[model samples]
Target chain A: MISEEEVKHIAKLARLGLTDKEVGKFQKELSSILDYFEKLKKIDVSDVEPSSRSFAAENVLRRDEIKEEQSKRNRKLLELAPETKDGYLKVKPIIKFS
Target chain B: MEIKELTIKQAHDGLKKKEFSAAELCKSYLDRISKKNREIFSFLEISEDLAMNQAKEVDEMISSKKEMPLLAGIPCGIKDNMLVEGLKCTAASKILKNYTAPYDATVTKKLKAQNALILGKTNLDEFAMGASTEHSAFGPTKNPNDLSRVPGGSSGGSAAAVAADLSIFALGSDTGGSIRQPSSFCGTVGLKPTYGAVSPYGLIAFASSLDQIGPITKTVEDCKMVFDAIKGKDELDSTSVELSKIAQAKYDLRNVRIGVPKEYFVKGIDPEVEKIIKSAIKKYEDNGVKIEEVSLPHTEYALPCYYIIAPSEASANLARYDGIKYGMSNAGSPASKLLDVYLSTREEGFGPEVRRRIMLGTYALSSGYYDAYYLKAQKVRTRVIDDFNKVFKKVDALFTPVSPILPFKIGEKIEDPLSMYLVDIYTVSVNLAGLPALSMPCGKAGKLPVGLQIIGKRFEEDKILEIGKLYEHF
Candidate 1:
């Protein structure tokens, strides 16, 4: 079973601010879920390789030259930012800059 | 004849023969949605302007001598997760409630190119998390089959829209049985095409590996038509697979080999649902097709494996919703409240189920636990795929129940997440294996509907369509 401290750590990692009640709820529920997942330990999966995707695919690349159409799309995407300046996304810094 | 109830093929033919104009077709659905949507809560928003304008274009194409494109003028309800430019693509969460898509999704672009009339964006479980639409911040979408019951979710709104005749057909994304279970409850035909079969270019990532978009229609034929119209490799989604140029052998019931996994009819299944599904299997036997027992031995582990993997990927995928991007941002000071922006924004934006998943995912993918949880699930996932590959070698298709139970009441499983998660037991394996599966109404148990699931091998959608069409009564 996972502890409340672990749940708090996970909440921080996930960038979620949880109330004391919600954290308590998650501590109980997540532990039960984790306990349920304990069943996987019985399976001997040593020889098996993990499957990340359903089907095989290769990275697709196109000519590296810039196209006018792409610039138009970039402008549109920039508009989705909560704050932007000079066609660039603007966000507060994690560290102080001199 | 009810214009709102016409299948895609019927509507396509009717529009060609001038029996009704595209505007009339659009108006019929719009009119129905306006009248019935209040009670069902199927639609999050109705794009009347987009529908009318697109309908008028189709009408003009008809008025002139030009031939209508395939699926043109047939109104469809889109799950809100798909980006439809200028329409609010909320995925039924407050985070994106006010966020309008800047550009069209690949599927939306294709549908528009064909002149398909889109009714509006429909509700879903927030971020497509839960088995029932009750998880929606917008509120639950009631099953049209029984008003007191739920339209199985997270695609509940899409299924309900089709079942209630609010829209003729709809698009739904399935990540852990979102499309199929709801289709079962609502008595609509839903197909989760092979993973990578349909492009996921603009589908909001719930669990990227498990996610797929497919049709929820009134008939298997309509499902096939919608699938044909929307499927093709897109340059944007590298995971998307191209339809093979080599023609696949046409499948017919007389020569088909279907496998019935004994594991599907396990205990905990509603007895009435089991009886009805047995009858569906019997119909296939009554036909000339070959049926035999096949074992997907790892089936028992699929649900637990999915719970780990899906949330793990979702935790990573949904991290993009941090404030300072185009979504509902928590208003605060930039420097001190910067961390608060992400925390407060997500806290306010996400619902309980979404939070539960994110927390579970964060824990699973966290350091020290990744190998035990996420990595272990992936290995099990590989075995799940291997199981299907082995079964398909013996059978052309596999038949199973979409959900173990019938359309459950709205509040019945709401508080119990485990019970709600179990409703998808039979369907999650298909996603885990990346195979094509279709759910169609087999028979009724009491007043509720039962769904017969037809699963096919990787990218063999043609086979499932043939099998599903045989069972589609509507």
Candidate 2:
């Protein structure tokens, strides 16, 4: 079973603030789930190469020319932001002045 | 004629013949949505005005004596995860509760270009994560067949919408059986096209590598029509591929070979569902089609492997909802740091199942555990792929039951996430291997429907659809 600290660490990495009840619940759930995933350890994958994609995908390239329609789309996207000023999305301060 | 029971072909023919106007057909569906949507919860938002205006355009075209596309007058549902350009695309999550799509998804664009009337956006599990729509932040979509049971999901709303005749058809994305499993429960025809067969541009990303958008319809023929309209390469999506370059072999029933994977028929499957699937295979054999028992030994590991890989990708995809750009944000308070904004927004915004998956994925991809979990699952994924590769060489298509059980009760397995994940055991391997598969109603396990899954090789949608068509007639 995974420890509660590990679950806490994972939540921190995922940037999620969990209530104490949720932390306890996830601790039990994630432990059981990880135990189920332990079965994969028995398989012999020494000779096999890991594959992330189901099919081969070649890189697709295109010209980087900007279009008038894209700027219109940008304006629409900016409108969705909760806080915007001068056509820029506003967010909480990133730097701390201690 | 009962407008509710009209298939795509019937609707198209009726429109061309002027038996009824597109506006009339559109209103009939809107009327049905008004009457039934409250109980089933199939649609999250109804685009009544947009649908009416599109119907008017089709009516105008008919009057002008212009040729019409097959989907020209068809009113359909877009799964809420795909963007529809100005429509609400919530992905059935609180995070995107007020989020309106600013662009059209490639499939939506394709459907719009064909003049297919958009009825509204259907519901799904938050970020298409759960096997049932119970994870939907709004509410669960009840099965039309049995009000107490769940319509399988995260494509539950799309399947239920089609099954309840709320929409002529609907589009759904499959990542680990999201489309086919729900179609099985709702008794609608659904296809999960080969990876890259349809463009994923504008689809709310789930597991990027495993994600595929396909159709849910009343019949295989309608599924084919929708697939044809939305499929093919797009410049916006790099993974999208043109299927025309690959030559398809015409299948003859008498000479075709069908394999029943032995692993899928084992314990845990409801006996009635098994019996129905076996009988469906018997009908194929009765038709002079060769039936053989095949073994895909890696089948048992598919669900576990999928749990790892899908979550790993989902973690990365979901990281974008950090309260800065569009979506529900919790950053308005004084002295709120950027990190605190991410934490509080996500904590308040995402549903439980979505949070569980994101956490699971984050842990799996994190340092020290990455090679043990994610890498190992990917290698097993290769074995799953190889199993399909070896079996397809011996058979034209493989047949299995879409799910082990019937449409389960709404709250039965929601608390037990593992059991919910187990629901996709028989369907996830196809996604892992990037193969085309379809779920068609084979027979009934009592009043509940059983679906026969027909899986084909990569880019072999034509072959499987033909096989499904053959069984559909029988």
Candidate 3:
């Protein structure tokens, strides 16, 4: 079962702040989801190759010609932003890694 | 012409007969949006000027002795994830709420080339992360059928927009059944084209390999029309393929072999859903189409494989939203380093479910768990595709229920992420297998709609469409 502490840990890794109530709630919910996944474990995939992409596409390449025109429109996009400072849109400071 | 309820084909015919102009059709849809969308919350931004201007150009072309394009005069609802030049393309998140795309997605350019009028971008779960649109920073989109219930999600607004007649058709990205599940709930036809059948350029990535843009419309024919206009090779989109230029299918279904996997009809599937799907399968039998019981034995493992693989990709894809260049910046915060800024911004910007997945994804991709989880899931994914390939050798298509249950009440599954994940059980396998699948309303369970899914071989969307159209008639 997914415990309250485990839920809180997952939330912390997710960088979310949750109350005791939310931790308890997600603990129960995530535990049930894990239980449900247990049903999938019953299936035998011993011989199956794990699939990431369903299509058979591989190593697709494009003409790497630098399209200088679209980059020129980048400034036009900044001009449309609701708020900007020092040529960049300004906002509240996010978390900084020490 | 009260062109609000007219099909794309009908609208095209009306434009040709001079009974109504493309501008007139655009105006009617705009008026309808003003009246209906207040309750539906389908469209995020309606471009009155862009739509009318394009409509006027299409009308002028008709008068100037030029041939009308297939989607000419048709107005479509675009999911907010797609970039539309000059429109604020927020993925329904506050982080990029005010951000506008400077250029169009390749699909958007193709639609513009066909003279289609874009109504507006519709709402979605923040960054297309959640199955229920409740994660959207804007607000939850109520199901069009019953406002008390959810319209089945991240693409809920797109499906609801078409269901509520706000637009003729909508384009939605399906990563693990976002488009098809919502279409099933909303009682519209939704298609998840084969991976790379349509270009993904300018589509804000949720999970790059899993994200596929497809059509949600009132009928299969409308879907085929829009698919033709949008599906083609684009130099800008590396994954896109030049799917058969023969856009329309001339093949008949009488000789096609159809499969119904006994495994998908497993226990816990709601009885009402099973009844509806079985009834749909019966229609093919009545048509001279051969039916066989095929086994996608690896079907049950799809959900666990998806949760691991999708979140792993999501964790990597969402790394670009650091507060440094774009989105919400937290520079002045007490946290001193660059990583703190990145974490705090994402913490504040993303909703709970998105965070949960990101964390789950980060865990799966972390050093210790990579082989145990991510690599293992990839191996299982290969098995799922192999299972499909084996089954397809016996049948042209596989029929199944879109979701095990009908649309739940609005708050029913919100507190339970597992329940929400369970909603995509039948759908996750299609994405895992990378096959084309369509969901059409087969019946109603009490008040909500029941969707019958037709799964076709990779790139054989025409067969799925033919079978889906037949089921619609059924």
- What is the CAPRI rating of model 2's predicted complex? high
Evaluate candidate 3 and give its CAPRI docking class based on DockQ: acceptable
> Per-residue lDDT tens digits of candidate 3, residues B330-383?
656777765577666776777777767776786667667677678888888888
Q: Would you estimate the TM-scores of all the predictions?
A: 0.97, 0.98, 0.91
Report the lDDT tens digits of candidate 2 across residue range A1-98: 77889988999999998999998999999988999998887788878988899977788999999999999999998988889999988876677789
Location of the lowest summed lDDT over 10 successive residues in candidate 1 chain B: B329-338
RMSD (CA, Å), candidate 1 to true, equals: 1.6
- CA lDDT of each prediction against the hidden true structure: 0.89, 0.93, 0.83
Q: Individual DockQ of the candidates? A: 0.74, 0.83, 0.37
TM-score of 2: 0.98
Candidate 3 fnat reads: 0.47
- DockQ of candidate 3 (2 decimals): 0.37
Task: Please give, for residues B1-474, the per-residue lDDT of candidate 2 as tens digits.
Answer: 458788999999999988999999999999999999999999999999889999999999999999899999899999999999889999999999999999999999999988899999998999999888999999999999999999999999999999999999999999999999999999999999999999999999999999999999999999999999999989899999888988877767679888999999899999999999999999989888999999999988888899999999999999999888989988775635788899999999999999999999999999999999999899999999999999989999999999999999989999999999989999989989999999999998777998999999889887888889987787
